[model samples]
Target: MSIPIWKYALSMLTYFVVLLCITELLRKKYKLANIVWICSLLTFPLWLMGGVSGWFRWAKILSVILPTIVVGFCRIANFEERKGSFWEFFQKGWILWFVYGMLFLNILEATLKDVSLGNYANAACGFLLCATIPFAPKFWEYSKTGEGDLICYTTVGWNFLYTTWNLCFVYGESPNYFASTICILMAAELYPIFKKKPELYIMSRVYTLATHMILRSCFGTMFLKVMDASTWYNASFAKYWGILNFILIIPYLFWYMWQLHTGKAEISFKRGKTNNNVTTLNT
Candidate 1:
């Protein structure tokens, strides 16, 4: 299928507007963690635009990579601003490296294959699944504290679902599907390392991922059937799926916004006072 220029343009514009709104909201709410969440959520556009080579592809790369690098670097250097132990550093660093490295690889793959922007965007989406893997640890750790449980579970579920959808419906034999599957499985494996209730967490992670994958596959199949029913209906099946995915994302969006708002309170409650010094985690 030939890439539609207008559709890509509209998607890019929509992405920019959403990103700007999310950024403004985060700033107003004083929520930095939401930045990452926002970046992840916004990868939808990057996925779409980067799949086909265009200005939007470059825009997508900059949007995801720049803030990720900036935030990761700041967190590492400004230990006073964010307190963590050596293990925490190691965990976050690994995630940072994974995201950045996969992003580099995605761009390189696109360049080498001389694929269309659509395929390039698909590559970007595949890389996002890769980025989500390292974050599983952090999400699992935070959830064990009895907070952000929904967000943690939902994201784990969503990425796993995304992997399944790509494999069964979008790209069964494609290398991207295989890579995404590996990433999702590896991410699920990291859940056990975060807490004492390792078994429960591991089970929950698996269930969530599996459930989401099934749901997504079913949805995709049904949607395709509906579209195949008629040619005169002017159904853009891919666009519809994209819209459905975005709508399904609303819960996570709100969950993340809440997390950002409450994060400050949680930090304040834990610290009592904002101390600009190195804070160590209990081993």
Candidate 2:
């Protein structure tokens, strides 16, 4: 229920805000809404400032900016932004951003004269992802003003899943329910956009608030006294944390499974008269 301290305090809070700034510069990066993009700038100290001092600040900053620059470069040339959603831009163009993080780690190892394949691993993934962007014409298409980037449910689903997975690994056992909650809620908003289920938008907000309250009450009664206020990533709290995160997201996960099932069962969209009959899926 509480925003994940690592996320709020770490890269997500900062990057969400900072990168939201970059969104203003892009053609249309804010999938949630322009208002949500503005709202992302506001964060609480309990979430962002309470973490383990400074970590991934630069990496997150660069992550937001590097891709924006790459995606926006095309726009600056002709005075129009790129032709993809924030996820698509980010989905396809995570190369230099990720590579930069890896390069930083690699350089750190080299600076310490350490030896390991960590740098190699970073380079490998970075190189592979980066290589495809140039050839991916979807990453290059330019649409008219009202015709924004076409949203894809499959792509958005992948992004959402990957984001959750990364958050789990990045936080380890002690996961931040707040960040994860907001992400799920936002992900839920996509259901309305893609599936014409705007009711989920309200449902997501209610669910997020309710979950946070429950977590707060439960944690304060059970584990808050024992939790390290300074850090959530510890053996002492990780199990409960991971459990809470998993429990907190069960609704969201179910939502994902349902969408996937429906996606397979029905054709989201098709041309001609089918367009009138078939639903259109969007990220």
Top candidate, metric TM-score: 2
RMSD of each: 17.0, 13.0
Model 1 pairs in collision: 50-120, 50-121, 51-117, 51-118, 51-119, 51-120, 51-121, 52-117, 52-118, 53-117
lDDT of 1 by residue, 233-267 (tens): 22254334434444544564455456546774334
For residues 136-232, write the lDDT of model 2, one tens digit per residue: 2211222233323322222333334323433433344223333433344444445345545232232222223233332333342233332223244
Clashes of 1: 10
In model 1, which runs have C-alpha deviations exceeding 4 angstroms?
Answer: 1-157, 164-169, 172-236, 264-283
Q: Where does the lowest 10-residue lDDT sum fall in candidate 2? A: 270-279
**Winning model by lDDT:** 1
User: TM-score for all predictions?
Assistant: 0.28, 0.33
219: Cα error in model 2, Å: 26
